[model samples]
Each structure stands twice: as structure tokens, then as C-alpha cells.
Target: MAKVLVLYYSAFGHIETLANAVAEGARGAGAEVDVKRVPEPPRPAHHAQAGQSAPVAEIGDLASYDAIIVGTGTRFGRMSGPMASFLDQGGGLWAKGALNGKVGAAFTSTGTQHGGQETTLFSIITNLLHFGMVIVGLDYGFQGQMTTSEIVGGAPYGATTIAGGDGSRQPSAIELDGARYQGRRVAEVAQKLHG
Candidate 1:
């Protein structure tokens, strides 16, 4: 079976919610998903590791998966710092062509409609590109966008969730569908590429 790595760094829980939806979508598409959280390092009483990036909540070996779906919260029109840092640490993998030709997708959560959800998704996608991964995006043809109960998900770029002003908005039915569709698409593409 093909494995999809659903990696994320969620702060206010909205990103985490989106990650679960993405996983569900992958499962529905007949893919095995390994959900991994980037591990955050413990805050030191004193300033330790002056040049280190922010602590990750979890981490995993990306080479183990056939595809990777990264999710994060939008921060001022960009991916969160933690996610960026994690991507930066993937240089070793890129140098060795570890993730080459793998299917890649991105998703994000934002506070408002124009809160940089698309930008965050692109930022994540850019990092994946450096690893020679093929990017996957959401298409309007999917019925989920038009039939969803709320306007919480879907983008020309990829799957996303509008988490609302207070960050408590649940993902709409359409958004969930979009996520799953994207997941299935990635799985299908990976299978073809691998075969």
C-alpha cells in the first residue's frame, strides 16, 4: 500500500483539525497515512542553542513515505516559522534525492477569508519543490466545493480551512470533501509514478 505522510505544526488547534480532515481524505482514497507531529524542544531555562530554530512538536523520516501532505497555520501570509525551519532541515534529504518524484500537497488554516491561506499553502509547496516532489492541487471540478454546507474549504491552490476570526470555526463539508479528494489524487498519482 502507498503511504502518505501527513505532517503538521498546529498551534491553536485549527491546523490540527485540518490535518485530521486531510488524513480522512487520504484514507477514503485508499492510501495509508502516517500522521506525525513535529516534536518541539523543551524551552530551556537559559538561552540554549542560539542558532536553533523554534522547537518542533514532532518529526518523522520523510523518506519512508511515498507521498507527503504538509499542513500549517497561516502567519502573516506565510507558513509558520516552525514549519519553515523543519523544511530547512530537510536539506540533507534533498541533497541525497530522498524525496525525489514523491507526490506532495499542502494545506493550511487561517483566521479570515483573506488571511493568507493560499500564501501559506504556496510557501509549503515551495519547500516541497526543493526536494524534487511533484505538487498536487485542488480543482474546481470536484463536487465538494459546490455541495459543501459551509464556505470553509477549497482553493485553486490546494485544500484549506477558514478557521474563522476566533479560530474555532469547524471545517465545512465542502472543505472536508476537497481535502479527501486531494488526498486520493495524491495517492493515485503516487501509485502510478511508483509503478
Candidate 2:
């Protein structure tokens, strides 16, 4: 079975919810999966809200996994500081091209419809490229991308969800479905390439 890692940084609980959906998809695809989060300094205000707690990732080597999916909350059209800091520490793996040929995908949460979801996903993709990993993304086949009646987040670039400016809105069922598709697609690819 392919081994997949789902790593993410969530300020509130939305991204964490999305991450779990992704993990479920990956597991359903028959891949061994590990869901983890990057460490960040405690923010009491953010912590006041209930969120899923994941073990801080101990990524000693990226080569150990056949696929990796990263998610984060956007910070002004970019990845959150904690996620950026976590990726920055992967220089050792990068130097060795340890992640080369592995499947990589990204997801993110933003505060508004235009709140840099694509930019944040692309930023994570850029880092994955630096590691020489093969990139994966949601395809047009996913019906969630065609929704025009309700506010939802899913695009060809990656999966996403709008958290609202006040961080009140949660991911909708359609958004979670898109996230599941992304995870299943990545896992299937990883299985083909590495299993």
C-alpha cells in the first residue's frame, strides 16, 4: 500500500475538518495515511475555539512517504507563518531530493471568496516543486467545481473553503466532497507510482 501524509496548519477548525475529509478519502483509496499538523506558538484567541488537535509532524525524511498533501489557512494570499516555517525546515530533505517523484497536492482555507485561496495553494505547490515532487490537483471532473448556486470552494488548482472574515463560516458538504476527491486522486496516483 502507498503511504500518504496529510500535513496542515489550521488557525480555526475549518482546515482541520477539510484535512480529515482528505484523510478519509486517502484511506478509502487503500493507502496508509498519517494526518499531522505543523507546530505553532500558542494563540489563546485562536485556541479558544474548538479544533482538532494533531500531533506535530516529525518529518525526518520525506522519502518515507509515497504521497504528501499539505493544507493551510491563508494569510494575505500566502500560507500561514507556521506552515511556512515548517516547510522551511525541510531543507535537508530537499538537498537530498528525497521527495522527488512523490505525489504532492495542496489545499487551503480563506476568509472570503477572493481571499487568496489559489495563491495559498500555489505557494504550497511551489514548495512541493522545490522538493521535485509530482504535483496533483483537483480535475474538472469533480462536480463541486461547477456549483454556482451556493458559495463553495473547489477549483482545478486545489481544494478550498471560505471561512468568512469573522471566521464563522464552516466548510460546506460540497467543499468537503472536493477535498475528498483530491485526497483520493492523490492516493490513487501514489499507489500507481509507488505501490
Best of the candidates, lDDT: 2
Q: Distance (Å) between predicted and true CA of 187, model 1?
A: 1.0
- lDDT for position 50 in model 2: 49
On the 0 to 100 scale, the lDDT of residue 192 in model 1 is 78
Q: Write the residue-wise lDDT of candidate 2 on 7-37 in tens digits.
A: 9888788889999999999999999999998
lDDT of each: 0.77, 0.89
Consecutive 10-residue window with the lowest summed lDDT within model 2: 43-52
Mind sharing the TM-score for model 1? 0.85
RMSD of each candidate relative to the true structure: 5.5, 1.5
lDDT of 1 by residue, 20-63 (tens): 77888778778887777665435421221232232333333898
TM-score of each: 0.85, 0.95
Candidate 1: stretches off by over 4 Å = 41-60, 146-150
